[model samples]
Target: MELDDVDWKLLDLLQHDGRMTFTELAKRVSLSAPATTERVRRLEQAGIVTGYAAVVDPQRLGLPIEAIVRVKVRSLDTPRFRERVVALALVRDADHVTGDDCWLLRVVCRSMVELERFVEQAQRYGDTTTSLVFSSHVRNRPLTRAVVEGTAVD
Candidate 1:
C-alpha cells in the first residue's frame, strides 16, 4: 500500500498510544474522524497494522530473571523442538535464525533454578547456550517513516 504523510503520522501516533480514540487521532492528523477511521481500516486491511497490545514489564510481574537461550537442535529433533518450544510458558520470544544456533529464545523466570530446569529440558533436543540479561536499553521502539524509508539521519 502507498502510504501518504497522513498514514505515516497515523502509524506513529497509534504506535505510541494504541488506545487513542479515533477522534483524538483525527485531531492529531487534521482529518475528520470518519476519514481517519477509514484510513486506519484500510491500513488494517492491508495488514500494515497487525494488532494492538498492552506492554507489560516482566520484572513487575515477579519474573525478574530474563535470559536469551541459543539452541542448536539436532537435525532430526527440529520438529519436536519447535512444537515443545511453543508450548513453553517461560519462552517470551523465539526465533529460528541462521548461524551456529538454529533457534534463539528470550525467556523469563522467577529464579535461577527455574531457568536451569528450562535449560535442562531444552538440552534434551540439542546443545543449549544461555545468557542472563542484566539490562535492556531498548524494548519496543516505535517505527517512523524515515526509519522505514532508509532516510533516517542519526
Candidate 2:
C-alpha cells in the first residue's frame, strides 16, 4: 500500500499515543475527522495498523530487571534446540546470530534471583552470559518513516 504524508503522520502520532481519538488525531495530522477515521480503517484492513496496545511499564509493575542473555548452541542444525528456545517462556526473544553466540535473548525478570533461575534453566543450551539493563536511553517507539515510504523495515 502506498502511504501518503497523512498516513505517516497518523502512524507517528499513534505510535506515541495509541489511544488518541480520531478527532484529535485528525487535528494533529491536519486531516478531517472522517478522513482520518477512514485512513486508519484502511490501514487496519491492509494489516498495516495491525493492532493497538497499552504500553506497560515493566519496572513500575514489578518486573524490574531486563536481562540480555547470549546463548551459544552446541549445534545450530539441531531442530530440538531451536524448538526449546521458542517454547521457553523466559526467552522473550531468540535470534540465531553471528560470532560465538548462536542466539541472543532479551528477557524481563522481577529480580536477580529470577534471572539466575532463568539462566539455570537455560544451562542445557550451551554457554550463557547474562547482563542486567538498568535503564533505556530511548523508550521504545515505532517505524514512522517506513509507514510513509511503504517500504519494508530491516
Per lDDT, the best of the predicted structures is 1
Off by over 4 Å in 2: 76-85, 146-154
lDDT of 2: 0.81
Clash count (model 1, backbone only): 0
lDDT of 2 by residue, 96-140 (tens): 798988878888888789888878766676888988877778766
lDDT of 1 by residue, 61-138 (tens): 999999999999998998899888746998999999899999999999999999999999899999999999999998
What's the TM for model 2? 0.80
